[model samples]
Target: MTRAFLRPDDARDLVAEQFGADRRLTALDRLAGGSKKGVYRLRLDDETTAILYVWATGENYWPPSPTVPDDPFTDASGAELFATNHAALAAAGVRIPRLLMLDRDNRHLDADVALVEDVGAVTLERLMEHDPAAAATPLSMLGDALRRMHTTLSPKYGKLAAITRGEAPQTRRTEDVIVDRALGHLDAAATRDARLANAHDRIAGHVRLLRSTVTARETYGLVHGELGPDHILVTPAGEPVVIDFEGLAYFDVEWEHAWLRMRFGDAYPVLRPVDLDPHRLELYRYAQVLSLIEGPLRIADTDFPGRQWMLDLAEWNITKALAVV
Candidate 1:
């Protein structure tokens, strides 16, 4: 009962109010949505057309915590960012979902959702669960897809100053800024300076190292910002398609790559630097694990593996955080 639901009519009426009418539209089922948006499954009258309904988040939207409101479309800027960013990616020859419509009104709907062509693909988590032998297959494709994403398209997203970036949930953040904000909540914001409590020095060191070592150009491209089996979808034909660009932003490729390794036991792609700068990677890895240790770090619960995932990442991070080297 952690989550609630918005009915098919409620979804349609709300979406229709913001998105306008679909002549022969059919009822839709609100399924799962991540941090900034709501995702719904819509079936056309013809039964052949499948449209994914997305509604961003907004305050006063519904009930409070403990039986969370089903609404996902809550913000205005995020919807706009999602549209333009994804559109740019598509135009750049990247394979992304086709946008059917986008709203930018910060009112009731908050212009917080977009309609896109849904693919009958299975999430990487489902694929991995169904067949373990097929697990590595997704990882390889993911590497190539991610490389293309980071190398080719990321630079297109210009970096805005901290305030501007912070305004939008799906903000473009350089490593330093991201660290400060993400770890800020963990800090003693209740106090005057909002100290990061026990984690201040460690987080600062990682942030400094990340800022100094990662050159801008090599990492300048658009980062998925968040990459996990859940965010990636592998089709029935074995094709890899990525979704959820809400958090897609400008960031360091290495930071993102280190996060990716956490999922596969921190031992994938042959585990480079495991022999060299393992300490640094460990710190980097722990920073991310620590983020997940808090409930708010997650985008959604569609594929969340629970505290086990967090504990595992934390264990790996702690093992490395304590490394004598």
Candidate 2:
């Protein structure tokens, strides 16, 4: 009876323009697990489907933070960023959903919307849940896709949208960014939870201690800033198509692997992350843990329906942070 985001009819004109005037939108179901944007599956009269991404203010549940949007690690949203990363990845031979339409001019909807080919409901996460053995092939395929993405090098380390548009390159070293961002998260989390506050200095020292062991690099690789089984979709034929390219950027591959290790857990080794820098991985792993803490807590502060899940995530990561000290 009530609607927080765009209704099915709200997107009627937009869908019609994309699929032609004859194709009618039968339904638009908002999928779960999106905190920064509204992800909807649009079913058509012809029994076809497409995914619509709407960057509306009502859709984002992340509470405002000190970090600016330009930061490589900040909230990755907006249609321009999506278009830029999509083009970069698609050009790099990554198998992602085909972009059907992009309405940046707001010709159809008041918000910036993009319509992409529907890869289906079988996420790599879902497939693995049904049968871990069957996920082996998809995991291996994901490893290959990640390799291709990581091999796509960039001279500058930052969001593809910023660097490619002639903006000044991110001059600071990757390690510097990691340390600063982690400290920022530490400070934020401390304000909310007394446990993090008590262990702040100790955990901060641990982060810096790990950072001290890292060396600088001359180049960076393209990475799906957040790569997890959930971010990947498996086609019926067993092909892996990665989604959520908004955070796609050229950065330390270890940063990507740290996230991969966390999300993939025991299934991580299947990706075969070889020749990685241990020092970078360790430091990034700690930083990533802090991020998981702050991110969930921030989202939970809003009207997110998964408030309990977010708090639990922050609590779990809090234990993780305190344990290492």
Candidate 3:
């Protein structure tokens, strides 16, 4: 029950034990691009490499209000949830890193950690920035992979718990969850800037309309809540593999589509086509903007850099979302 963060020696010891007494951990390098978790690239004496992901505690993770008493929307710790999600997605034939071992009980490490096979690939975000046209084939492949993943259906929609438990986590309707999150984020944004109050009211007025759009959907599917380019990696063989399952949930497919469209625009080719409702997508896009703002606003008091840039981007997106709504 150590309260201290896991150090390099701790990780090396765990990796050595998992591999063998003879096989030593040669190097442990912390990887970037994770906000809520710590990822390390580990190299062994045998020349094999792997990734170690340490899940964030509730205190460090975002979307939990520190000021509000009895905040019901806090995200549960992702340690066990990430392990469960990896198992479920791998079983469904999704292209994810091979999970070697999981430490959920915090016995081997201070926090939950997972040792996974490193694909030794570059992230799609870097590739896209270097050459968008050259990255087309891989992007299309990712679209196909996502289409396959969407086939994973669930009985109810909400958080990752619903997907793991195979039932709704609570009695509240999915529409209520969506609306409440939107309102919560909007309120948070308004607290930082009074100008956002009007935006909040405008979006609030359209809650019923937005709810109707979500309710009209006949089925719920597994959603990679944050499927941006950074989470996707392209292998040397030109295959795309997905990573980061902490945000996985059961929700309307349009929310996933909207995320891609907002991030990649028309350049991202949606291979497996669906009848997209533009109005609904726009509403969700607004919700997405609000969600993006929520995290930065919630942590504004801290010394986190790039907070202003995020708020600026959120404001810009809000303007775009408002134009359509």
Which has the better TM-score: candidate 1, or candidate 3? 3
Write candidate 1's Cα lDDT for 160-250 as tens digits.
2221444323343344444454354234221212223444566556655655653333235555656677877776666666777655555
Q: Count the backbone clashes (under 3 Å) in each candidate.
A: 13, 0, 0
Off by over 4 Å in 3: 1-6, 56-63, 66-77, 163-173, 212-215, 305-309, 321-325
Clashes of 3: 0
**TM-score of the candidate numbered 1?**
0.64
What tens-digit string does per-residue lDDT give for candidate 2 at 1-325?
A: 1337878889888876778899998998999988888999999999999999999888887778887334596767899999998998888888899999998898877789999999898999987888897799989988887888888887788888778787736667888888988999999999999999999899999999998999889788988898899999998888889998899889999999999999999899989874689999999999989998998888888778899999999999999999989
Q: Any idea what lDDT model 2 has?
A: 0.88
Clashing residue pairs in candidate 2 are none
Candidate achieving the largest lDDT: 2
Tell me which of candidates 1 and 2 scores higher on TM-score: 2
lDDT of each: 0.50, 0.88, 0.70
RMSD of 3: 3.6
RMSD of 1: 7.8
How well is each residue in 145-263 modelled by candidate 3, as lDDT tens digits?
78776877866665565545554554565556666777877787778766677666776777657667653555677777778888888888777788887667777777788788877
* Span of ten consecutive residues with least summed lDDT in model 3: 66-75
Clashing pairs in 3: none
